[model samples]
Target: MFEWPWKDIARECELYLGPAGFSAVQVSPPHEHIVWEKHPWWERYQVASYKIESRSGNEAEFADMVKRCRRAGVDIYADAVINHMTGIPGGTAVGGTSFTHYDYPGIYDFNDFHHCGRNGNDDIVNYKDLYELQNCELVDLADLATETSKVQNTIAAYLNHLLDLGVAGFRIDAAKHIPAKDLKAIMSQLKRSAYVYQEVIYDPAGPISYADYTPIGDVTAYDYAHRLGAAIKDKKMDGLLHIGENFPASNDSIVFVTNHDLERTGDPYILKYSSEDQKLYRLAQIFMLAWPFGYPQVYTGYDFTNYDDGPPLNEQLRTLPVLSSQNQCTAPFTCEHRLPEVAAMVDFRNQTDGSFVVNNFWSNNTDQLAFSRGQKGFVAINFSGNQLPKEFQTGLPAGKYCNIVGASYNPNTHSCPNMIEVNAQGKANVVIQAYSAMVLLNRTTASQKKKAL
Candidate 1:
């Protein structure tokens, strides 16, 4: 639910994403920030105050949304923007709070922020210098002195407030710019344990490394996206056999196909959410969900022509409702998670949670690939232009399983619109169409339902 307002996210969790088997959602930064006239999306990342108010919602609305979403079995992981303050020198925040450089009223003062006098303007100009990168400003944003006790306490208090409101975790934004020691100090100040994942974009040449943060919590494995995007674009499915290699440990990585940033970059290395590349992008998501890799997250955000353009906003610049009419996500909202194929695969991932071993792996040496999750589930992807018609070892118990990706399966009614039959030898001869996928789950194994021809 990228860039979705708090209230809309709450409604969708109870109505759709929760029932659809989604575990958690990474939401936009809940902290107050500069309310630029243009209302660009990146403005949300530039924090003004610790108060939980923004284009998303006010404090009361955010609290209620968190409570409702948690009750629906969906946890809320807020994107905590503790790395820096407002990029602008002085401005009124979204909550109407006034603040100037290093002088947030009742929050931070001049001494609280870092004045790393390295570059002429104290801005981060050298990525190779770890000290300047950590202490200096990022894109003219006021860098917090996270190492000091006062600053760490203030940051911890803000996070503790969210935790009190039932937040499940935090996505430490700009984590690469903050020293690992400073982050650990802030985490220690928290009253209780919460899931923490850092945004340490993998950079082998840089002074700081993803490994530095792995000891603290899971780090984003951006290389996975780079490798995956390039492979999919090249129609080289076989190369993905070693997808997670040379990255963070599987248990300590958070992975996704395309996030808000990558989707807007127009980067050919990874697929974006667009009409022209929707098929391949969807196919890549299917593979990511099925394959045993890092903890997977399905990104669903609004479509934007300009990178700076924010989500659909009302006259007041507040985010509009996600869906348009008839509960269907229309223009501006890509709603990738709501897609039947992606939703079914969420169930696929959940059902095959413990089946980490990737067995019965088969590939056409080109664009077609099939693999099984230790008899729990099997997925076959056909990326080529031609329909892939062949028999493959599925490694599931012999039975008629529903093709959950293409159709629906009602367990109570024992109805599956589309079915794939497996013989006693645990193999199914299936024809997967071009740019489509076939997913079979043990839970979807239908015995009483009449088999499809």
Candidate 2:
């Protein structure tokens, strides 16, 4: 969600994208934050209090947005930043809430935090680095002492409020910094109203294991994002096959191409590195959405030359409106989610309902990758330099079907930009273009086993 009030935006989202299958909208942090006149946009991550008042909107507007989104069958997920509070000192938040370092009378003070500093670094001196990360300052921000009963109550109350508002889940920012035990405590306190996903960027070899966060909720599969991006950039089609193969079978993860923080912090490894390779980047996203492993998050970004620059804003510093009427993005927005192939993948995932990836996977070892979602749906991707001939195993019921990824289907003639007629043997001869993806659904008939010969 943007910084502006969500009433109108949520309403419009429901109007346009809702029909296109957007079941959820992840809003920015809804807490109050210390607003700096010089860099107002930085206020997003800096938390002052758990109150539902900030650049996004006030309490009433937030409630209204939730109601409207839920009414449209879309759920709201909050970006919960419980790791730290505002970094600036001697200043009230935009909501006029006052706070001080080592002395938060309204909540708790620094003494209430877990203090264990090897050096005299007041910034974070405590739970053996883990405690400080959770209870001390993060980038000079006032860290919440989640270990304390008072702090836990406050955080729990705030989360409960959002849950009561009918949010679907949460995205815990900087979760790797926070201790797993404290996170479990916080999770135990909540009324189980929403799902909790922690941000643990685990590489191939990391100090922390994803299993730590799995006890609480799903951990972000940051490695998957990096690997996918790398494969796309190198044009290493074979490397792309290794995607999701590395993910631990036991733990669930949230996979995404990019997020607000990564895009803002200029993570060269992901987007910046793949800047010159747009086709590959898009193909990586397609494969991610096609393969069933973790919960997939599709990013809709605004084009920016500078990484630190905020979303398209007006002179007043408020986020400018996003135009989705033309099925295209304008005014510096990189609406990758609107692409026909990407949108089709979302639809495919929704239709698959997290089924196992059928092992009958086929790849040309060059550009084409095809797989079936058990018997529900079939997908073929063409990433080669040239168009592919009409040939592939779709694993669908024997019948004629329309390609949902191409042009919209006309109910009258049932004509679409792409069509396939599956033979009695449950195979489809699919032709796809370079840098394109095709998905076919067996909406007409169910996949039944062949009779014993």
Candidate 3:
């Protein structure tokens, strides 16, 4: 979730993008946080109270954004940061909520935290070491002992309040830091009201497996991002064919190229560490969106020279507004989510919902990748700096259909660079540009006719 003034930006999103097919807008934490004079935006993750009084907006404004977004057929998913609280010095939250090092009268005092000196330093590592992760400080942020009934109820109340306000789900932050059982308890309390997506950065060598958090909710597939990033850089389209084959088909995973923490820490996967690397990063994102794997999240970021630099904000310490025009963003704001290729994939994914990826996959072993989605949608990618001319099975009922990638008619005509038409024989002679992707929609499906009716 990108943190901005929701009251102002949410409406624009609802009007322009929401109804077009966006199911939800993942909002940053609505909870109160510790405001720092030097880095006020750091408070976004350093939660103080569950009260809805932060930079995004007040409780009323939040409710309005929810109602408006829901009215536009868009749901809201909140980024729930329950792992720790304020760690910076002399930073009080905007809602008048305050917490000192290891001391929070409203929540829990700091001494209650664990101080195990392990990894050659005092830090939490795993569930078996629950006391340290839950109670000990996370990078100096006041950790909360979620195992306590009081803390559980407090957090539950906060989550339930959002549910009552119409939020559809949550992305649990620092989930691996908490015990699995404690997370299960918290989720059990949440019940069916909000969908939970846990953040457990996968490290196979580590004690925690994704299964630990799966019982509570969907776990993020960090490995997927790593693999996709590598394959794209290598220009190994055959490797792209292997995408999503690694994860169990039964589990729901949150797939993302870059996130708040990754972008904040200057994760090399994004920000064009090199020109070639930047193109590969964009290609990986396109591939991720095209493939039928996990619940995908698109990242919208801002330009930054330093890892610690925050979102573009005004002198008042509020985040700047987002610009909605195509290929243009507010200065310093990089709205990759609105890019033509990225936005096109959103439509392609939504249109092919409930479709499975068919197996007759093919790739040039270097720069071209092609596959069909359960006879419903077909896609081809070309990245070899040469036009791809190939005939592939589309699995569609014979009819002339507009290629969704090249010429989608929804937003407007000539909106995209390439447009191909598939004939009645379910065959397409695709000629794709070196750095582009093409997707074809099966036009004669029963669902399509039913929708037409």
- Candidate achieving the largest TM-score: 1
lDDT of 1 by residue, 1-453 (tens): 888889888988888877877888888999988888678999899888888888888899999999998898888999999988887878888788998878998888989889998779999887888998899999889999999999999999999999999998999999999999999999998898998999987667888988789888888887788788787778677789999988888888888887878777757787776757788889888899888888887888887778799877787668888765567676788787877787777777777876777998888777889999887889998887899999989999998888877756663343587788999999999888888888888864422211000
Best by lDDT: 1
Cα lDDT tens digits, model 2, 299-334, are: 765666654555654564445666555534466666
TM-score of 2: 0.86
Instruction: State in Å the error of residue 34, model 2.
Output: 2.0
**How many residue pairs of model 3 clash at the backbone?**
5
Clashes of each: 0, 3, 5
What Cα-based lDDT does every candidate model obtain? Answer: 0.83, 0.68, 0.68
Residues 114-203 of candidate 3: C-alpha lDDT, one tens digit per residue: 555565445555545545655556676666677777767777777888898878888888888878887778877874667788888766
Where in model 3 is the C-alpha error above 4 Å? 117-121, 125-135, 245-251, 264-279, 324-328, 407-425, 446-453
Query: Lowest-scoring 10 consecutive residues by lDDT in candidate 1?
Result: 444-453
